[model samples]
Target: MSGDVTLLLQAWRSGDAGARDRLAALVLPELRLLAGRQFRGERAGHTLQPTALVNEAWLRLSGLERIDWQDRAHFVHVAARLMRGILVDHARRRDAAKRDGGQRITLTGLDVPAPEDGLDVMALDAALARLEQLDPDKARVVELRYFGGLGIDETAEALGCSPATVKRHWQAARAWLYDALSPG
Candidate 1:
């Protein structure tokens, strides 16, 4: 199944419209699951649902003219990243609308505890951008594991690294994020 998906992705990259459609059909369920996991961490009154997120990500992905997709893992990683951007953009807009009462999103079930309330999505996004600047691999580990809801093995597959490497990066990224997010 993965091999077929990979082939479809490759064909899509090469501008095969049918391959693009087939790939979307093949991966939409998994993408929905990933997006659903992400929305579970959102605030109770959040506007965007999981399906909406998936749709937005799909729309954004469809607009990309060229992508050198490596395989299923790579496609999923990109989808997760797109979903994250959509959520962050939504958060930013919501925050801008309510400056004094910005929206908050819980970062839960990623082996890192959040404050009793929740974390500001924009702040976390900014911290991740900084982390990317410092260590792109570590940041990607965080993105796949935390935001993407990928397991260590899955993240390793996406990153083309050993699970041990994923574990190390995950631990370090979590610690760094905790410190960066902690208030004085």
Candidate 2:
């Protein structure tokens, strides 16, 4: 199944319109699941729905023309990154309007105990940006694992690194994120 998705992605990149449609059909459910995870701990009456998130991510992905389209994991990782950007942008817009003081999302599945009030999306994005500057590899590990919802091996595959290395990065990144996000 992964191979099929990868082929569809590659074909889509090669200018096959049918391949794009097939790829969308193949990956929509997984994308929805990924989006659903991010929204799991959000407050009631949030403006975005999982389906809407998936559609937005899909739209942004469709406009991308330069990606290499390596594999299913790689494709999903890119989509996940885009979803994070969308969420952060949404949070920033809401924050500017002083709507509920911005959107807060849980770090529940990132091997860290999320604060009871959840972490603000904009804050997390800023922390991640700082981490990116400090150590890009570690930041990628966190983005792929947390935002991409990738497992250890899948993250390794996406990063073209060893599972052990992915594990190390994940541990180190989580610690850094914990410190960066903790209230002093």
Candidate 3:
């Protein structure tokens, strides 16, 4: 099944419209599952539905013309990354609106424990950006495992590293993020 998805992705990369549609059909369910996992940790009353999130990510993905699709894991990783960007952008806009008397916004997930109350998405995103600068491999391990909802072996495959290495990075990254996000 993954081989088929990979082939379709490669075909899509080559600009085959039929392959794009077929690939969407093949991957939509998995994409929805990923989006659903992301939303499960979101604040109650958050406006975006899982399907909507999947659609938004799909739309953004459709616009990209340069990605070298390696396999199903790679494709899903890209989709997850796009969804993260969309959620982060939404959070920033919500924060901006709140400054003008709009409702406060909260974002959850990324497996960070609630800090006193809950995790702030914007702060996490900022800290992640800094982590990316400091140690890109560790940051990617966090992103793939936490945000992408990928398992240890899957993450190892995606990163082309040993599972032990991924586990080490995952543990270290979680600790670093926890400390960085902790109240000062």
The digit string of per-residue lDDT tens for model 1 on 56-137 reads: 8888888888778889888777887887798788887887887843557777754445666578777788889999999999
Each prediction's total of clashing residue pairs, residues at least 3 apart in sequence or on different chains, is 0, 0, 0
| lDDT (tens digit, per residue) of candidate 2 on 74-161 | 8978987998999898888888888766877888655555666678888889999999999999999889887887889999999999
Q: Rank the candidates by TM-score, best first.
A: 2, 1, 3
Which regions of candidate 3 are displaced past 4 Å? 100-117
Give the per-residue lDDT of model 3 (tens digit) for 40-83.
65567876688987898899988888989999889877876787
Give me the displacement of residue 119 in model 2, in angstroms.
0.6
Native-structure RMSD, model 2: 1.6
Please report, as a residue range, the 10-residue window in candidate 2 with the lowest summed lDDT: 108-117
lDDT value for model 1: 0.82
Better of 1 and 3 by lDDT: 1
Candidate no. 3 TM-score: 0.89
Local distance difference test, candidate 3: 0.78
lDDT scores of the candidates, listed in order? 0.82, 0.86, 0.78
Best by lDDT: 2
